[model samples]
Target: MKTYETLVAEALTVVPEILPWDLQSRLEQAPAPLLLDVREPEEYAAMHIPGSLHAPRGILEAAAQWGFEETLPELVRARDSEVVVICRSGRRSALAGRTLVEMGFKQVQSLKMGVRGWNDDGGALEDADGNEVDPELADEYFRARVRPEQMGP
Candidate 1:
């Protein structure tokens, strides 16, 4: 029998090191994974992976929003659909992915280094108001708002 991680990794058809650039291609070829930004709303608004859905970790884990049926249709179309959770780093997303799995989401994965890594790798990011933002400006905003050291487990 496959371990959960093994199963998920295979289902997703990619691994963490393959950062943001391959994302567009992945979406084109396979079932587009539901790109979930699990950071705070403010942090997410400042900049995030393009085409991701906003489901902050707090909201996703909170009992109120789990398996929200209203979003199910969109979820289903994203490659038979899988939810890809992301945060500043891999930690929170890993936890979120685990929770989704428990909730019977058969396929889930965490973006290993979060959007921060994506930005560092020259990935395009959009602003809080859903406008295009210069990468440098987004970096500054994220640096100011995302206190990684202060984040809680």
Candidate 2:
């Protein structure tokens, strides 16, 4: 069976990517890219890129269009705008970006290395409280703590 890495790799072939520093610069320009954080609610509530719209990976398709309960007006309107998809790691965003492309979104890209790399590269992150997360604290949060049982065969 194909692994998660295999899927992400396939998506990466089609999804454009931007590094954290480049993203920071792009954010300063006119018509800043629409940032989409596709992690679960709890993960997003913990911390995310400021002004990012949270549409979990599970509901992305719905959120991208109009008339659905999950529809995000901004996303629907941004079909022609630059959009950046982000996740804890870069993997999910790659797949999500590909989905956006398939759905006819123009100028879609993934945040390479994701929020973890952003924090590592001194990019700012705000908690649910809107307080900037300390780099050290973000580091703690990003540590991979997979239990033995979570490993696949």
- Cα lDDT tens digits, model 1, 1-153, are 877566545534432333555654666776567887778888787777778887765656443143564343444343335667778756567766766665566667777667766777677788767687787775676574657887668
TM-score of 2: 0.96
List runs of model 1 lying over 4 Å from the truth.
Answer: 1-18, 61-80, 144-153
RMSD of each: 6.6, 1.0
Clashing residue pairs in candidate 1 are 31-79, 45-128
Q: How much lDDT does each candidate structure score? A: 0.65, 0.94
Error of 1 at 67 (Å): 8.2
Among all windows of 10 consecutive residues in model 1, the one with the lowest summed lDDT is 63-72
Residue range 9-91, candidate 2, lDDT tens digits: 99999898999999999999998999999999988989999999999999999999999999999999999999999999899
